[model samples]
Target: MPDIKKAGNIPTSMLAVASLLLSAPSFAEVYVAPFGGYSFGASEFNIKSSGVGNLASDEEGELKVSESAQYGVMLGFTTTDPGDIYLLYSHQSTELRTGNNFSPSPITDLDLDYLHLGGSLYFPKGDVKPYVTASVGLTSMRPSGEYANETRFSMGFGVGVAYQVAPSFSVFADARGYATFISSDSTLFCNGGDCLWSISSDIMWQGQVNLGLKLTF
Candidate 1:
């Protein structure tokens, strides 16, 4: 009876060890994810005019910002431990339209896009994960009419939360603020050969709110 009891305990211990080994490999496998969402925010265009443009001020401000739809893609790989680290890259783009209240004045359509490469540190508690991240990348702003393309080197930082709902699905929300260096150039006006103007403005900081779907693998 003593030998039978010892033999039964040996198989139980062995089964427990096997279970541990099977779950261990899951901690190191790479994870891939892609997401999309909408953005509702403001894109402030500071127009400083030279060469006969108009008269709003030495600095013209267009603050008539409206809600817009934006979409993007993201890829990330994370360590599988309960609390771990991850690196991700994502690209998001949107269109902004701004105009002055007065007529005969030129309307500006500003197309803005962002490219982000960042890393995140996550503290996961069961199905809920909270994370913080920092990213440095490019912001491209293009104005219709006579303004040249403006590209800025910007840095962003934010904190957000994600909740896993199923085996390979989650929902996330994030809000990030950008501090950027503004670089501007002007183009020749289409009306005439001599219709050329140079515009300059001070760089302004902006913020955005994003909510979307997250797919985890």
Candidate 2:
């Protein structure tokens, strides 16, 4: 006859798999959210047009980026603590204008993109939840007219609320800020004779507001 306790014991591997399954879907989930927004905070800087990679040139003019539409998507994995970790990607198409903000000026089209790994913490109250989030990532700056592309380290933070209408769906709106780190005097957007800008600031900032729908499963 076999020992009763030994015979009744489950295999360790079997127990492990069982624990994982029970702790998984019930305690965690994955979600996808798509958002549309307007990004403001058009940053203005001094561009040294005659420098040609020279940072000390005094011949400079004010340049400004125009505010424009932003669109993005997030892929997130929820935690047991009513929050989630997400990867975010967003883009904006705008223009770099020379001279005053309201004047008709020479325009150079530009594209800005951000990629971040981020997380959120939530305050759940009934069907509504409020959350705060933060992230660190990279920003890619692409300028037209023979300028070279530049990539810089960046950070973002935001606060928002979401309303759940079903077990796997919700809608949310949020406001966020993005700060990009730059070398104060590097030839970031210049490409030779036509090159005009060595970034004048050590940091650049922008603000955005978004509205979106989330699907969780």
Q: Pick the candidate with the highest lDDT.
A: 2
Q: Which regions in candidate 1 have their CA more than 4 angstroms from the true location?
A: 1-46, 52-67, 80-106, 145-147, 183-202
lDDT, candidates in the order shown: 0.54, 0.80
* Deviation in Å, model 1, residue 106 alpha carbon: 7.4
Model 1 weakest lDDT span, ten residues long: 187-196
Residue-pair clashes per prediction, in order, are 0, 0
Q: What TM-score does candidate 1 reach?
A: 0.61
lDDT string, candidate 1, 1-217, tens digits: 1343455556553344334334445544344444444545554544433345553434343532344555554554455444332333334444433355323343555566766565667788888888877777777666566646656677878788888888677787877676666545442222454322333434546665666566554
Error of 1 at 82 (Å): 6.7
Q: How would you encode candidate 2's per-residue C-alpha lDDT over 1-217 as one tens digit per residue?
A: 3343564677553344334434556667878899999999866775565555433356566676689999999877788777887778999998877663223564679999998888999999998999999998889889887778879999999999999999899999999999988777666576754556655777778899999999987
Task: Show where candidate 2 strays beyond 4 Å.
Answer: 1-26, 51-58, 100-106, 192-194
Q: What is the lDDT of candidate 2?
A: 0.80
